[model samples]
Target: MAFQCQRDCYMKEFVTTVVSCCPAELKHEVNGKKETLKGFNVKLQDTILFPEGGGQPDDHGLIADVPVIRVTRQGPEAIHFVASPLAVGQEVQVKVNWERRFDHMQQHSGQHLLTALADTMFGFKTTSWDLGRQRSVIELDTPCMKPAQLQGLEEAVNEKIRAHVPVTVQLLSIDDPAVEKVRSRGLPEDHAGPIRIIDIEGIDANMCCGTHVSNLSHLQVIKLLGIEKGKKNKTNLIFLAGNRVLKYAEKSYSTERAMVSILKTGPDEHVEAVDKLQKSVKLLQKTNLSLLRDMAVLIAKNFENNPQKGNFFSLHKKEGDNEFMNIIANEINTEETLVFLTVGEDKGPGLFLLAGPSRSVAEMGPWVLKMLKGKGAGKNGRFQGKANSLAQRAEVEVFLQQHCKHQTSEEE
Candidate 1:
């Protein structure tokens, strides 16, 4: 059963009687995000809005001035989900969003033109397609499309639109001989009506249920963006048609202007400028690492020169990393002096390291790490890993001092 919108694509308003209105919850997606709409499913005597089917989105409009969120086909009926309920047998005005509906018509018809041209001119068959909010995609059976082939196909499609060819819809009985000649993927199991054939004059005829423009000229113009890899051995051709082409051009110009300001270069040189900037950053990182290593060696030499100060040495550097801490530990003999080092904020999360007499480090490393709300391991005379808190730094130092005194007494 075809809705009024399909019969006459230009129809925007219809007067219909409400057959039934029942509570319904629709779960659907918008811009890749899932949304739930709680409303009433309304069945009308007939609808001017097309339901979602045949790869086209549902029409959104008003049913008796109440916002209609979605319309879906259940068997042969178009069920409208409206924000408010209408009493059964009531007469209401159902209006289509002319702007949105016309956009869909232009795109759907544009796809038909592209598919038909690709088949004859390039020998690439369209396996599937999707009509997105901003752009549309057509999956070709081939693995890829070359620039020349794409340019040829785009030119051929625009030629047809320039010719102002007529687009007409014909409803044929299921048993009609012409039904077998038209292109089709087959019909739904619950479909209970005549077959729909969309004929583009001498171009092609395909079976479809989506709304479309009456003439190819209504498509305005089409722009082929590019191609993307598809599942298995397929190529997806991305395109924009009609009003979408204008929208794309506006956004692209704005982006180019912004990049010109930030890059301090024209659009033609922006890519080369960004490439050079990336190379410079990599060079600076290497120079910084070399400087950090030199600083680490110097700090260790000062500690070694003052041996009479104490056997225990502790230090913290806010911007230091594991490599910096390890360098200091290696410069001094942990067997002679206990070394405790940390990096990052004194009272916040950071890393810690302990290198000293094997027995002392092994006995004390685990508990010290636990007190800082962390977990690590000690092997030989070194313990290191991440710690969540360093607020208990004072207490940990006192514990290490007492442990060092006990070992000294035992040695005496």
Candidate 2:
């Protein structure tokens, strides 16, 4: 038997079937395919299941010692799929996982309470609802609500929960003339079957397909997590209820405690402690730069006194950092003499070399690099590149002797 609801609401009916019994083992074949079993192709008249529809997840539990893997709606009936296929004419005692079911119910009911509150207190209507794992969100017709106003709405919802108002479900034929009396935003009015309407005592009444609790008290608590702007003057709000609210509270407390311990300060001073640490880092950077300048000056003085007696002179040294190396290179390049300065870590040869003006050093730069199995190019009497080995210093000196002679003979 089917009847349409005047209000366009949906009510879930609990029905029990009585039939002759046989032992049926629930079989789960859908899990192998990693797909949610939509319908169980079984012959049984002894089970009642909540099917997957209306944004509600499937119900799972044991039916006569066989695991009911999933429940889904096929046509107009709810079918229960088990872990093992059930034989024809088998009797099974069906049980639903009350914990999961109740959690879903709380979330659904909380959504209605919040939506109704938004309509009554602020003239904001709920356009849609999405019941998700861990949290649920509702979209309102208004674009934004002040934080203080949302907090008030949360307080008002929890007050209704504390009052423990009864929730009533009513079924009405869709073709009934009274259907126009109950106003709603999202439900389609011309549907075929009876519509279910859930009423929260004096608080709210709405059209919804999801399962819900019998009273507001089952929600235990209602917390508004946050609100954000949605498309076209709409607002999305996230919320938590019952056990979810408790879990969030516990997690927040643990985070604050850890922060206090790390900062070695009370809750109020943690932010200030982080600010002080940032300032200390900035001061240390300035001190390091000043020390680098002093070290570069001392290295340049040493290079002036110990010039090599040749047209080409190259000095390789371990410097404090790359910035100090560039500073020393700039100082050496100012003089008219020919010199090459290479700086690197002490573990191996330098990766960067800078050459000053001298014909023999400029010519030997590429030839000596080629002898060391490295490649480089230069113009305007300066060259720089990587050296393959620290031992290549001897090869560099010998190459300078050979190349400087050719330059000296040309000058003569």
Query: Highest TM-score, which number?
Result: 1
lDDT of every model, 2 decimals: 0.90, 0.66
Tell me the TM-score of model 1.
0.80
Assess the local accuracy of residue 48 in candidate 1 as a C-alpha lDDT between 0 and 100.
90
Clashes of each: 0, 18
Error at 134, model 1, angstroms: 2.7
Tens digit of per-residue lDDT, candidate 2, span 1-412:
1211112113222233423222344434554554443333442453444556556676666656666666655454445655455545554556667667777778888988998888899998888778787888899998789988898999999999999899887667766665566545544333345666677888776655557778888889998999887889999999998888998899988988998989889988978998998898888877877787777776666665666544444556665455665566666643444555556644465654545555544655676677545555666655666656556665565565566566657768
The digit string of per-residue lDDT tens for model 1 on 111-150 reads 8989888989878899999999889999999998999999
Q: Pick the candidate with the highest lDDT.
A: 1
Please report the TM-score between candidate 2 and the true structure.
0.60
